[model samples]
Target: MRPRHPRDVLVGYDGSDNARLALQEAIFIAQTSNARMTVVSVVPDVAATINAVWLAGGDPAQLSREMRIEVAATLEEAIEQIPEDVPVTKVLGQGHAGPVLVEQIDRIGCDLVVVGTRGRGAMRALLLGSVTEYLVRHSSVPVVVVPPPERLRDDLA
Candidate 1:
């Protein structure tokens, strides 16, 4: 049985192909139910060094600026894909992906959180702990994980 009536819905859109698929589902539910929709993009906190070398020659500010600009552009592209009839607020959450998603859901009082995943095997998911798996277990609110398009097609077949 599917759940009915989502009040405030949040979608974690990282501009990935799977995320775009998730956004489509989110838009449908939000539009049909007239629920408030928020599209969230989570960016990892800036790290200047990978090993001994600095990302931008030890310039954290420059690295931060560049990442933000790229992320913003991706966010805008995602926004453009959204229908104007369905209102969606864009939000940029900073931190690790999983925690940022959980935090935004709580801060925005979102009852439903939609996310996208590659839908890897159980062993791989347990070993790597993908964000979808993390959110599914960690989030106090409801989490709906939308798998990649091919996975959905295969499931239908």
Candidate 2:
């Protein structure tokens, strides 16, 4: 069950267009409700990262370190976009998006969780899974999922 008024809000951000939209919505909610806000960016686990780098013809060990650095920079940039009036905390999570976010929600004791849909569609999401789909099923608190803009939605379709 969701609280009538949330005291803490957590948003999953990945520096994507849809994530930016979700961040905006989270900012608005936090401002209006006077709730503390947290933004988190999750990187794939070490094994997953290594596999991806190896498959992409990169140095598995060295590239994973570089990838983490890049992701941290991007997460910091996303944090900067939040307005000064809205107090926010930034977190970098390691592991899959859904579980990492759920863990953050638990750690922060957030009352609401916000994330953007990847727009992978039902079939693809079922096959490969998506963070949004996982949260909808697993999150303990209420979740708000922001979809891509209409123009982008057309492209996704």
Stretches of candidate 1 exceeding 4 Å from the true structure: 1-3, 48-58, 119-129, 151-157
TM-score of each: 0.81, 0.85
Off by over 4 Å in 2: 1-3, 46-58, 120-129, 155-157
Report each candidate's C-alpha RMSD, comma-separated, in the order given.
3.6, 3.1
For model 2, how does the per-residue alpha-carbon lDDT over 1-157 read when each residue is reduced to its tens digit? 9648788889988888888889999988999998889999877778876788789898987876876888898789878988888778889988888999999989989999988876565456433227888898899999998877676665455
* Span of 10 residues, lowest total lDDT, candidate 1: 47-56
Candidate 2, poorest ten consecutive residues by summed lDDT: 120-129
User: What is the TM-score of candidate 2?
Assistant: 0.85
Clashes of each: 0, 0
Give the TM-score (vs. native) of candidate 1. 0.81
